[model samples]
Every structure is written in structure tokens, then in C-alpha cells.
Target: MNRPTVVRTRDELRNVLAPARRAGRTIGLVPTMGALHDGHLSLLRAARQRCDVVVMSLFVNPMQFGPQEDFASYPRDEERDVALAGQVGVDVVYAPDAAHVYPPDFATFVEVGGGLTDVLCGDPGRRGPSHFRGVTTVVAKLFNAVEPDVAFFGQKDAQQAIVIQRMVRDLEFNIEIVVLPTVREPDGLAMSSRNAYLSPDDRVRARALNQALTKVLEVAKAGETSTERALAEARAVLAEAGIEPEYLEARDAENLTPVTRFGPRPVLVAVAARVGRARLIDNVVVDATPANEPMAASVDTTGGAPCVGRC
Candidate 1:
């Protein structure tokens, strides 16, 4: 078994992929922050299907975390991450440190605007702009370093995926951003590295995030056109379950404009809430009429968050 080559510096990564680039071969990049899960594996699978080679970047970004957020304690197991990447047929593993990525004079950052940095969970102080700023900065660096033909991001972080696509378009990176459906646990909880913080009991309550989102979809599918009604009911569901609902938004999946009352537009119902030690988020794009199937396609394909082990 030939293990995936481990790269520790930007120069090394670029050199590793140079041959493929020169040969006009396609490459897919799956950027992740360690703590491998089925969700990350799903991204790997998506990249494998579309490209000639796969490069999985594993680095926990401290810039994305807030003052008191779980940056230092974020889950990390590079050994395990690399092992799993090899299993999924990853060709190379690029793992860079802060010094290598953001040297002593690294004062510049890539920020995105157009109201994307301040909507839904990415709002002002509640881990929105700054969080996304860090995400985009790291992603831009990765895109430049490897210069892959395409990149993959999971739908579990629906807003993140949208924001990244916007950045790529605005900044004009010549790479395609492909989003796969959100991978979920058997119990409906979205698979996340943050899930490691959930205790056994917290794990059970975490399902409420999915439950609340699902109820909104059910109501929407049942001919509920009132955006406020779907959001309120889902909020109530979370409140009743002792979960603190942060934001519930119904927006056009394309431009991400806020939707007042549902209509013919593609609407993505997204929510974020604090469940125990974890902050969970989930969304589903509902078609206009009740007879229509759910819109899983966000910026590319179509359908709602797909269940794992079944799709």
C-alpha cells in the first residue's frame, strides 16, 4: 500500500503537485482541519470522483476561532487523519503549521463582502465575519499553494460553502468549488469535528438541531409559505428542547437574500443553536410548491441534506 505523501510546507506542496499541473492533469483539493470523520471522508469521495488526483489539506486554523472559542482545544489527530486519507485514496496530505502559513510579518488577510460576511451564523459578533475571514484566508492560501482544479466543501456548513464560492468568484480563482450534501449520523446529527466535545447526553440532545430544521422543511413541504411561520415553529421546537436558537433564516439559495414569504424562489432554511458544549448548524433548501421535491442543490447540484450510510 503506497501511503499518501505527507507535505509540511507550501513549497513542498507546490513541488509535489507541480508534475501533475505541468502535465495538464486535474487535481481536487479537500481542505480540512484534522479530526477525520465520515463527513470529511464524504468530501474526499466527491473529489475522487471528479479529479485525477486528490490533495487533502489538514490544518486546524486558529484564526477562525474567537477569543474564548475552542481553538487551542480543537480536536486534532494527524496520525489518524492521514491514515484515513490513505484509505479514501488521497494522493497527498499537505499539513502546514502556523509559522509556515502565516509567518512573522503575515499581516494581510482576504475578506469577503456583499452582505455574505454578516448573515445567518456569520453575523457580527456571533462568530460570523471574523470566523469567515479566517476561513477564506486559509482557503485562499490553500488554493494558491496547490492550485488545484477543483475543491470540495460539505453542506453541513452551508453558509461557509456559499461564502467560499462567493470569494472564489469575487477574487477570480480559477478553481471550481463543489459542495456535497451534508453527511449526518444515523440519528440525524450532522457529523462535525466539534461533535467530539459532545458528552453522551449532549449527543442525544444535539439531534434537536436536525429536528428543528426538519420540522421547518416539513411545514414548508406541507404548503406553509409563511417564512415567519416556518422559522417560528422551528425556533419553538428548539426552545422546548432547551436549546438556545441563535438564528433561523429563510433566504434565496442563489443570492442569499432574506425571504419574507416563500414563493417560487429557491429557499434555504438555515438555523444555528447552542446544544450543550457544541454549536450546531443545519439547513435544507425547500422548493416553492409542496408537490416539488426539496432543492438539495445550493450553488451547483440539487436536493436537501442527504443522510449518510444510505446515499
Candidate 2:
């Protein structure tokens, strides 16, 4: 397998991509914080299929981690990550160091407001808006550095994807945001780099997060429209596993508004729980239309539109 050329600074990355741009080849970026897994590979595969050139950003962004969070202990295996990216046909791996990404003079941040940052993972009592602020800042920097035509993200980070799309739209970044389905384990657990923190027992218990969302999916497919009813099913599932979710709620899939009942708009059933040392999150989007099919967990939008309808 051909190994991806690794570049650690903005200038090197730009120089590496310059040829592709001059050749009129579409470039795709899969931004990551290292710890390559099937979830990350899924994004890479999608990028390889969609664009002529693929660039993966392998920075473990400290800005996105809270002081008390696992920033210090987060997994980092650059060698393994690069090998995997190579297997997936990634053309370049832009793994910048902290100092390179955030120098002494770094002061700006990108915050996506309008109520998107105050809920779910961004709940004031949780990671809050600061987490997203870090995310947006790094992503904006990546967009500027790579200048790719399209960016690929996984739906497992549904809230993050939504927030990034909003930022792209508000900032008028000329790039397409293509979100793919959440890749899950055989037990239905959503893939996350944080899964590495889970003890064996916690790993088993973590399935409750997905089980709860699956319950919501079941009820929604059965014509259950009441958000409370759907959430109740999810709660029962979590309770059976002796897991108390930090948050288990349903919302408007598009705007993240609180959804009282599932009507014309699709409903996003999201859940977050801390098992052992890992804090895990999972979600499923249910189409409320008569068809009652499960909607794609993400939206694909271009030209700064938050999304193209249910894209």
C-alpha cells in the first residue's frame, strides 16, 4: 500500500495540495483527531470516492477538550493512523502540532450560535459552547489551509456536523459539507475514538446508548409520533442497562429545535451517557413522513446552505 505523505505545517500542506489545485482535481478533506477507526475510515472512503484527491487532517485538537476532560489521556497513534489512511487511498495526511495550529498569538475562534451550541453536547452543564468554539476554530483553520472542494464528516457526531454546516453557511465558505451515515459495531455501538477509554465492562454497557436510540427508531417506525413516547421507550432501554444518560431527548433534525411531537419534520433521537471512563453519544434520525423510513443521519449541503432540505 502507498503511504500518505505526512505534512505537519500549514505551508507544507498548502504546497502539497498546490499541484492538485493546479491540475483542476477536486480535493476532499477528512478532518480527524487521530485514533483511526472504522468510523474515520468510512469518511476517508467517502472522500476517496467523491474527490480526485483526499487529505486527512490528523490533529488531536487540544482546543476542543475541556480542562477536566481526557485531553491528556486521549489516544494517539500517528503511525497506525497514517497506515490506515494509506490503505484508504488518502493522498496526504496533514498532522500539525499544537504550536503550529495555535501559535502564541492565536486569539480568534469561530462560534456558531442561534441556539445550536446551547444543547446536546454543547449543553451549558456539559461541554458547553466552548467545546464547539474549539471545534469550529480548528475546522475553520483546516478549511483555510486545505481549501478543499468538499469536506467529509460522520453522522455519529451529528451535533458537530450540524454546527460545522452552520458555520460554513454563515461564514460563506465555498465548500460542500457531505455527511455520511454513522458506522456502528456489530452490537450496534456507535464508533468513537473515546471508546478506547471504556473498560471491558463499560464497553458492554455502552451498548445501552445505541439500544436507546434503536428503541426510539423502533417506536418511530411503528407510527409513534409523540416525542415523549419515543423518549420514554429510550429511557426504559437505558434503565434496563442500569445506565442513566446525561441527556436523552428528541429534536427537530434540521434546526435542533425541541420537538414535542413528530410531525412533518424529521425527529433526531439523541442520547449521551458516561460508562466507566468514556462518555458516549449516539443518535438516529426518523422521517415522520408517511413512508416512515429512517432518514440519513446527516445532510449534504454546498454553497453555504446549512443543508439541502433533508440532504
Candidate 3:
């Protein structure tokens, strides 16, 4: 088996892949913190299918985490991640250390500026203002370093993907931003690297994240249009499971903007909640047209079937 070549710094990565870049190859990038799983494999596979070469980034970004967040505890397994990426046909792995990516005097950042950052990730009350800013900044740096034709992101970070897409468009980056479906466990818990932090009981409680989002879809499919009503039902489901919800609402899939009056648009029912120390998130897209109404079959960009299961 041909193993994927691992590059540890931006200069090494550029040197190794210079020929491919010069040849105008279509490259795909899958960014993640170390600790690979089947969910990440799905993104790698999607990238493999779509591009001539694939680059997987394994950097646990510190800027995205708050002071009280688990940045220090976030898992990292480089050897395992490389082995798994090779097993799934990844061509190159870019695992850069913190100092290499961000020098001590690094002063620039890519901020989405205005309501975009505030709506989803920003804490307007000065709680976590730079959270999304850090995300966009690191992603912008990665895009510049790897220079991939396309980048794949898991939908478990739905708002993050939307934010990045907007950034790419606003900044005029010539890359396609592909959002993949959230891979889940058998019991409906969304798969995440942070899931490693969960105790056995916390793991069981984590399923409520998926269940609550599913409840929103159930209510929407049953002809419930009120966003308030749908969110109320989902909140009740989470409460029943003893989960404290961070946010649960239906919104336009493209913009991540809240939807007040729901009609036949493609809407996403998203949920975020804490299960022990780990924050779990999951979402389901609901096509609000009548049951008898036939629409075009839309496949998830992740190359999986659209999630249409019961709540």
C-alpha cells in the first residue's frame, strides 16, 4: 500500500507539492484536529473523489477556543491520524505545529465583521467575541498554504461552514467550499473528536443533541410552521433528556440566517448542547413541501443520502 506523504510545515508542504500546484492540479483539503475517525474518513473520501490530490490538515486551532474551553485537553494522535488517512487514500497530510503556523508576532486576522460573526458564534456580551474570528482566520491561512481547489467541512459545524463560505466569497478565494453531512453513531450521537471527553453516561446523554434536532424536523414535517413552536418542542425533548441546550432553531441552509416564516425552502434544524464537558451539535435538513410534492433529488455534498430518518 502506498502511504500518504506527511508534510509538517508550510515550506515543506509547498516544496513537496510544488510540482502538482505548478501543473494546475485540482487539490482538495480536509482540515481537522488530530484523532481521526470514520466521520473524517468520509470527508477524505469525498475529497479524493473530487480532486486530483488531497491534503488533510491536522492542527488543533487554539484561537477558536475560549479561556475556559478545552484547548489543552483536545485530543492529538499524529501517528494514528496519518495511518488512518493513508488507509482512506489521502495523498498528503499537513500537520503543522502552532509556532510554525502562527509566529509569536502574528498580528493579522480575518474577521467576518458585522452581524455575520455575531449571529452564530460571536458572544456580543464579550463572552467569546473572537471565536469565529479565529476560525475564519485559521481557515484563510490554510486556504493560502494548501491552495486547494476545494475544501471539505463536516456539517456538525454547520455555522462554521456557512461562515467560511461567506468569507471565501467575500475575499474572492477561488476555492469551492463543500459542506458534508454530520456522521453519527448508531444511537444518533454526532461523531466528534471531542466525544473522547465524554464519560460513559455523558456519551449516552450526548444522543439528546441528535434527538432534539430530529424533533424539530418531525414538527416541521407535520405541518408546523411556527419557529417558536418547533423550537419549543425540541427544547422539551432536550429538557426531558436533561440536556442544557445552547441553541435550537431552524434557519436558511445557505446563509445560516434565522427563518421567521417557513415555506418550501431548504431549511436546517440545528441544535447545540453540552453533554458533560463536551459540547455536542447536530442538524437535519427539512424540505417543507407537502408529502405529495415531488422535487429534485438533492444529494448531500458529502456524497451521502440526505438525513431523512425519524426524530
Candidate 4:
């Protein structure tokens, strides 16, 4: 087993991986805060298979957190994460401190304007207005620092993936954004670091997030064309499970845009709900048209056009 090398600062990371980058090695990056899990390991495996070298970034980005968000209490288990990264075949781990990444007088942020940020992650009441801005800014910094040929993100963060994809295109980062399927627990709950905050009952109720999306998929498969009806079924499932649904809708599976009517394009039935203090989200894609239908064709949510994909 090749133990993964840990690089704590930008200078150390560059010094360690500079040779590989110069040799034209295709590097893949999986960025996450510490506290590694099976879902994150799945991403590392995917990166290992596709790229010559894999770099996993373990930085708990404070910029992405809102004032009321749990930035202080966000989980951190560096030793465990480092051990898991080695087990999962990560070549190098970039673990940088907050002060190192962001200086005291740091200014400038990446903001995806034109209503993109305003839709999903934007602060409706200017509450989290800087959320996506922080995300894009840090991601941009990571891209520059690691200089990976490709980056991997999880589908569980549908909006973040969409926003990052758009950012890459707009900024011309020359990096491929590969999104992996959402890994879930056996009970269908999407895996998330935040799950640690859930109580036992809340953890059980969290499964409703996936269950609701599954119900929507069933309805769509049953020839139900009414998006409202499909969403209603999902809402009922969540309600029965004692989860307060924040949003339940079918949308373009690629851009995270809401779709009023289903067509031949693939639609994503997505749900987000709060089970106690944990906010859980899940989604399933459904074919808008039957296989026998003439116009039926698979949709690529991650490809072409913006605002067409949903989570």
C-alpha cells in the first residue's frame, strides 16, 4: 500500500506534485473538508481510475458558510481522513489551513451572475448572498493551486455542481468537471457529512428524502405527466416521515432549472427537507417519454445549455 503523501501548504503541494504535472500526467482532484466517508472514497476511486495521479483536497472552506451556519462545529477528523485517503489510493492530499488559504486582507470573489446564483444557492433575502460566491472563489483557487486536469464532485450537491460547471465554462479553467452519482446508505438516505448532526429519529426520517424522490420516479414511470401530481406524492411521503420539505419538484436534470411540464427531455425529481437540524436532499432521474415513444431520447443534464439540469 502506497501511503498517501500529505501536503499542508500551497508550496508543499506544488513541490510534491510539480513533477507529475510537468510530466503531462492527467491529475484528478476530489475536494472536500476532512472527515472522509465511503461516498468520498467512491469519488477517489473514480479519480484514480481516470487520471494518472489523484489529489484530494481537505479544506473546510469557511467562505461557503453563512453566518448562522455551523462553520465552527463542522466536523473535522484529519488523522482519520488521511488514513482513509491512503487506503483509497489517493496520491497526494492537500490540507491547508484557513489562514493560509485566505489572508486577512483577502478581497475578490467569483460570482456567477445572470440569475444563475440567484436561483438555487443565492440568498433570497440577501441572507446567503455570498454562499455561491465563496464556493466559486475557493474552487477557482483550488483549480489554480492543484492544476488538475479533471475535478470530481458528487451529484448530491446538484446545485453546486451546476454552478461549478458554469463557472468552469465561463472562466475557461481548462479543467473537466466530472460528477459522480450520489452515494447512499442502504436505507436510501444520501450520504453527507452533515448526517453526523442527526439524532437517531432524525436519521431514520432522513430516509424520507430519498423515498420521496423514489415516489416521484414511480409516478413518472407510471405514465403520469402531471409534474404537480408527482411532486404532491413526494410531499406526502416526506410529510408522513415527519420531514419538513423545503422543495420538491421535477426539473431539467442538467441545469437545476424547474420544469413546469415534462417532455422528451430527462427530468429530475428532486427533494430537500429538514429532518431535525440536518437538511437532506436527494433526486432521481425519470425519462419524460416512454421507450416506445418516437421522441424519446436520453437527456444529458451535464451537457449543453445552462439551467436545463435539476437535482
**Number of the top-ranking candidate, with lDDT as the measure:** 2
In candidate 1, the residue pairs with backbone N, CA or C atoms under 3 Å apart (3 or more residues apart, or in different chains) clash, namely 122-128, 296-302, 296-303, 296-304, 297-301, 297-302, 297-303
List CA RMSD, all candidates.
3.9, 4.5, 4.2, 4.5
Q: Least lDDT summed over 10 consecutive residues: which range in candidate 4?
A: 302-311
Residues forming the 10-long window of minimal summed lDDT in candidate 2: 302-311
| Candidate 4 per-residue C-alpha lDDT over 1-311 given as tens digits, one digit per residue, 9 for 90 to 100 | 58889988999999999899889889999888766666688888899989999999988888877787777997888888888989979999998999999999999788887555665446365324477887888889999999999998877777777789999999999999988777777787777787898999888888888788777767766777888988888888888987766667677766657786666776766666667876666666776554534212212222111111112
Task: Give a tens-digit lDDT track for model 2, residues 110-184.
Answer: 889988888998899988889888888989999999999999887777788888999999999999999877777
Q: Which stretches of candidate 3 lie over 4 Å from their true place?
A: 125-127, 289-311
lDDT of each: 0.79, 0.82, 0.75, 0.75
Clashing pairs in 2: none
Question: Estimated TM-score per prediction?
Answer: 0.92, 0.93, 0.90, 0.90
lDDT of 1 by residue, 1-311 (tens): 35899999988988998898889999999998888888888888778778999999988887887886877887778888899989988999999988898888888898988887788867875876888888889899989998999998877777788888999999999999887877778777777777878889888888888888888777876778898998899888888778887787889876788988776877888888777777777777777754555543422222123111100
Question: TM-score winner among the candidates?
Answer: 2
Give lDDT tens digits, candidate 3, residues 193-243: 778889999888787777777777667667787878888888888898898
> Which is better, 1 or 3, measured by lDDT?
1
Deviation from native of the Cα of residue 120 in model 3, angstroms: 3.4
